[model samples]
Target: MSRVLALLVALAAPWTPLLRAAAARPEHAPCAALALSPAPAPTGRPALQDAPICKKCQSTGRLPCAAHPRSDCLLEDEVLFCSVVADCTACAGAAWVPCTDCDNAPARARIEEKKASVATRRVALEYIDQTMKRPIRKAESKHFVLVWEMDRLKVDKKWLESHELLHLYLKRLEALYDDYCARMQITDKEFAEKFRVFVWQFPQDHHDAGLRFCRQSAKGGVKLMGQTPSYSVCGNKQNFQDDERLHRNIVHSVTHLILSAQRPVAWIGNIKAGWLDEGLAHFFEDRYWDVCDTYCYQEANTNVDFKGGRFRLAVRRMVEEGKFPPTAEVFQQNVDTLTLPMHATAFSYVEFLLNRDAERFNQLVKKLKAKVATRDALREIYGWSVFDFEAQWKSWVLSTYPTK
Candidate 1:
């Protein structure tokens, strides 16, 4: 390791296995009630039988954890389940403490249940924690768990601390999840596991995560695009120069994950379905960044010079010039084998079908997930064979795509 990397790891907080806090419960002797010198005859007034309710916790038997990482964990809806935060020394992921003033059995029991769940989740979701020896920061949204090791981030012309950026990225992931589900009509039950993402500042951590999670040995980024898709990238100046660029990287990778995990729980990237695999990822990249900056041929840096990564006009030009390949030929390729130009045509195919009718396109995806051929699925869902699809898509491109 280089001196710079060594220094950063040294600066990071050390991580150890979750250690249960050990403390003796202090015993308190019950105070003897001062009996009236002579037991007075009971008045007609009702006896004071109940313990006073804790006004601080609103009788809920919990107070917020001390030093709560609320700012980092904030989202539109409350983040009720997070493996990383559940280990907070104060509340143990329940985000509350027992209210000492009142004996609310139900509330205290609920907190205990949450604590137990936290411990279980922490053990199950130890992706980066199990791989990296150094201290790591973590955050989660409904669909994604983020492992962040980058110390600082540049967002909107200003720098944000690591904690601030973690929440921001979590929010971004959820936003994309919402869009993906809405477009595909996918429900929460369709997914098998929460997607895992790791952004590392050092090459070693990135490399280790790539091997462990993605099953690939890559220098830039590696993603496992199956049922429980995971992505790990070395987020340094060489691969991602700025925050906006990094955001693009993740959206592109996560799009691949969502499509693979939607149904049938398999990645079609290698099953002669490269057109949809690469096309859908490019579609989302362009959707958010207004440019398709990177291609997933491999997890390496790409300097796409085709119209500055803006492919709509380029694709239109290809169709008009008769430079585009046959639709059947493109459909026969896999993710790792697609040439740069073929990727552009792939995006156009998805654009043509999804824009014209999303419901039909969704049906087509379900068919594909079931191992049906693209041509067959299209014929069944869109009533078009390969030849028919090619003709219609080219005509649509000529009519709707801008010439500029």
Candidate 2:
């Protein structure tokens, strides 16, 4: 290689490992690879030690002299052209000394994990692009990559060819992701590396495919639905019947995916309260989407209409009938036992907490993500007992939610 290219490569080469290490442990600073200081000798240069040393110069605050590595600059290279200068890059060049154990077992494990993550991400992206018959750039800082099967969609092939619907879906998701992150107070780096999604065109296809892929069955008949089966994977059944329903299903399923990604515990134990999980997703599903404007920003409950007002009305009826399950009971229900009315109530409860104090809701989610128990997290973050919370939430629902 040319001298200039070699020098540039030497300077840049040290950063690759550091960047990877930093991504794995964002909480700490990247450790610099050092040059091993040699052992002392009476009348000759010291032998190089095994340990690495820092490269900074103490006095000049620049790169240390290579002739006397890590030194302030006492050694001069007399054989080079700029022989007089103690530390001249052109005359007295520096080279990176490979640190021992740099690619140890632990580092190799991390590399493998990163490679697996990238491969999964790439597959999801490719499937979506190819199936949609349109190219899309990979989304940056996104947890879930969407997969759609076009064969199951009910739309005419001519319509698909004419419109840029795929682009719109991706754009909406990107915007929604940003909004979700902002509301949840999630930093970009806190995002999980693995999140996969499949959106099938037909309801039956989505249901069967989800069960087959996840290697499990949903109890009480396989109803058409969208869900996050594992912490990292989510799937949805697209509705050719109603565009609104399709949007809602996508939003609901993706919400679960995002929440699942947030937890730091093992996948099996990472399940949040059923109410919060479903509520958060339902909350986003009902969020207003307008095609007229691109830059419009809507905060929670701002001119928001539950267009598919069934859930809202169902929740109101439950309150009037005095048959609503206690918040404690609802919290105990996993994805399996979550009834229809329970889903509505969950949505209302989430909306109540969010509209009342978004920051407190965020704190509640933060606590849950930290692996705190559902009951304890709610009590600590909201400062209310279960009974007290239920009472407050019921009153808020009865007053604010419309009966009609």
Candidate 3:
């Protein structure tokens, strides 16, 4: 072999096994081969004794946060990154305070280091704190910073305090984030920033947060849609009456924000892509809540029974009775212009596309976000014109949805 060719082959040989190992392991491992190294055989010797640990901290030199009930502090790893814990004067989001009873220098130093890391950035998350003159219950998860101010909520048939509610909502936000990523086939690298969401107890608080974060004032609830989307909601006694209602509202709003922030990073709601925008939002709302009651951007959803919120039967009947609007017309309108019936049909259209195949649905969205016209994107991905989509969606809704 030529000298340079031989050198190239030798250099490439080591990488092939490493690459294959990474492919073999679970997704997103930084170095698969190194991580997969076999364990060494144990030597015939006793393990070293651990250093003296505080009984409370167990040698970690950090104590559990006592600001909350013991049950709230005993969180799983997934729930550990919550902002309520971060906002706590005791733990400061670290989930661990220094062990006061014992003098463990290592634990104290580690706790101090974590506190230092979080301390520098507290101001960015302090808008609500500044307004309230008291800390609001807040939490963080994989893709969102959630500020929740509801005093108490009943979750899973049990009443929970403010901090407990924050942890539960943070967990749900992470789950929603995962579902969105899965449906869109998204990667971490595709996103530029995490979402900022606010769920307030009053309209005034909602309006304040909207002005600060969204730069627009709204009464019921409002969102700043696009890349880095924000949701600010006023959980009044009228619209958001209970836990279930509030959860559904947040889901609907976050769905819009996440879609707008993904990849191409633009809100299509105002650009006559309202069908896809509103449809997908409603689709996720129903997917989670089993019925859709939440509405935004004026679909006449205020106090309207609208099939008692069982949209499937309502949509199926729309097709059976031949009352649904024209596909091309509905697709042409902005989000604010859709009639209530049109919004129902829009959800069905998105559902039909998604139920047909999630990957294809993802491709359609990516195409639309890339500035491709909805007509062309539908044609390229599903081989259908808007008219064809209408016919197919109507057929599928009638066949699949329940008559009752």
Candidate 1 Cα misplacement greater than 4 A, ranges: 1-70, 73-77, 80-86, 94-117
Which of candidates 1 and 3 reaches a greater lDDT? 1
TM-score of candidate 1 relative to the true fold: 0.76
Order the candidates by lDDT, highest first.
1, 3, 2
Candidate 3 C-alpha lDDT tens digits along 1-404:
33543444466675554444334433434242333552232343111122343577665556767786557666523442455556677677666677787676766776676666556546666665786567677765567788888778776789888777777787788888888777767777767888888888777777777887887887767888885588888765666667888788888888999888877788878878888898988898889877877778742226654677788889888789998888888877788888888888888888888878888987877787777888889999889987887778877887899998
- Model 3 regions more than 4 Å off: 1-63, 66-68, 76-93, 97-117, 127-134, 299-301
**Which wins on TM-score, candidate 1 or candidate 2?**
1
RMSD of each: 14.9, 17.9, 10.1
Candidate 2 per-residue C-alpha lDDT over 1-404 given as tens digits, one digit per residue, 9 for 90 to 100: 33543444468676444343333443433333322222243334222233233343211223333444342122211111111121234322221122233323443343344334444544544543564355533331234444444332224343431112333344455667777877676666656454444445445544554565444443111222233333111223322234444545455655665665564522212254667777777777666541111001122123333334456667777888998867777777665466556667777888888888777887777776565777887778878888888889888878877677
Candidate 1, 123-189: lDDT as tens digits:
6666457567655777666688888778788899899987667777888988999998887767898
Single out the weakest 10-residue window by summed lDDT for candidate 1: 16-25
Cα lDDT listed for each candidate: 0.74, 0.49, 0.73
- State every prediction's TM-score relative to the real structure: 0.76, 0.51, 0.78
User: Whole-model lDDT for model 1 versus the true structure?
Assistant: 0.74
Screening candidate 2 with a backbone cut-off below 3 angstroms (N, C-alpha, C), the clashing residue pairs are: 34-52, 34-53, 35-53
Model 2 TM:
0.51
